[model samples]
Target: MNATATAAPKAKANATAPARGRPVLGRFPLPLRVLGYALVVGVGLVYLLPFALQLVTGFKTDPDAAAHPLGLVPTTPTTAAYQRLFGLSQAGDGVPFLRWLGNSTLVAVLVTAGRVLFDSMAGYALARLRFRGRSLLFGFVVGVMAVPGVALLIPKFLVLNSFGLFDTYTGMILPLMVDAAGIFIMKQFFESIPREVEEAARVDGAGVIRTFWSVVLPMARPALITLTILSFQGSWNEFTHFLVATQSGQYETLTTGLARFVSGGLGGGTQYPLKLAAALLATLPVAALFFCFQRYFVQGANSGAVKE
Candidate 1:
């Protein structure tokens, strides 16, 4: 009987060994794996080519950029474009690059703060509080997420105009203070927290406000960081809304100002180097931010995917 039992286990192992060694759907042969890696690398290069070109072009002179638009190596590498962007060059006299940068920074900061605060509060309320029409309100939020933003442009413009918020910082920041996606993300994450935690807080003499503020909110760092990064990036990159919201050049953020700069509002010629330099600078902040908090961003994204 002992020998029979040992033979039976050996037979099972031998059966499974063949299956393990054989190639499955994703487990290709060595040659195919190498080919797959090469394919992925090729695709990555295709996506990165444009950014590489943009960086190289920013250092090229106008004539160089015009002559060699696709060149990865600059004929005469120069800091002229960057100098112009920073107002260090006399040729950059008319460009209010500093003003655009300031406006973008201010708006992005305010909008991010507002969204983090308001979105979290709204999400927590929807997730925890037992209130009338809760389902309806959540459904409405989901509906808002489905609605295309472009479709609301006209209505947003009319509302801003009606409320005398047009051409003002308040109009730019207020409209974007609460985003449906942020609210949804926060609510989902909040719901994943165990109810017993909140009950424990209450037993410790914490009221609803105290519990939410000190107990629950602190545990939601990942979601808050995610929301902050998204809000900042969105507001920083926003152009169409700013274009419709404000007519004055004083209100121009980096995106709107860059659009004008590229369209000959600020420069006479193509000014490809200058334009690319400005764009590169504008992109740096968001890129840096994402790189810095990427781990938190990913964690927050997956936080609500499962509930225990």
Candidate 2:
């Protein structure tokens, strides 16, 4: 009876012990644990403070926002900023918010589509298809990725002007449609896929395009989702390219329009509330996309970590 009682305590101790190389927080000195938790909370708050301020300022009156820039609570809350953005009130503001939104949406969508199609095709050809100068072409793609985008502004403008695509939607989108980084991403992902799967499809009499579209593409959901989210976010948030691509006010996208709005436009009194509101709205779509597809992104990242 004594031995059995002693054995139970030993078993319980064993069960409660931390695994090797893994430190248990409970076992840490109490002061250290408290300090660690405080540090973590402090860091989190620091990162979140700006976003919190933005959200709060969006509801404040212009003067209130300017006065209490860091305050979490608005002294005088108002929706005038949102009203101006949505055109419900302040029609005389002349922001054309909806037009900017529509232009951004259209450009982002088309650019994302073009990237997915063209990048995937180029990636597949580089990864799987045996062709003349295949290595040379892939090397060129990698080299292109190294070139700073800012340096290409003059060349892009020259080409666009020469081709009569200047100030057009085609110029805005076509230049961004096929990104070398995207092609590299797709190529690396395609290379990671097992060749046996393609061979099996070939055995079943599927051609190259058929196998890629029907078999390989279906298995590439995680990578595709990652690429889609990136393409959407990049295209949506793009500012510099859009700035140079079109000069007409009619072609102004959200980024450019928001820049203009924040820079003394909308009655020229800083318009903190309006700027904050516009910034908040602009951030929503990318945030939503990331939250929705975060799992796919994680899966894609983990998949890339696997050794060949």
Best by lDDT: 1
lDDT of candidate 2 over 147-189, digit per residue (tens): 9989988888889999999999999999899989888888888
TM per prediction: 0.89, 0.90
List the pairs of residues colliding in candidate 1.
Answer: none
Off by over 4 Å in 1: 1-27, 92-94
Model 2 regions lying over 4 Å from their true place: 1-30
Candidate 2 C-alpha error for residue 15, in Å: 6.8
The residue-by-residue lDDT of candidate 1 on 1-308, one tens digit each, is 99998999999999999788875535777898888889889999999998999899999999999999999999989988888777788754646788999999999999999999999999999999999999999999999999998999999999999999999999999999999999999999999999999999999999999999999999999999999999999999998899889999999999999998888887488899989888988999999999999999999888967666
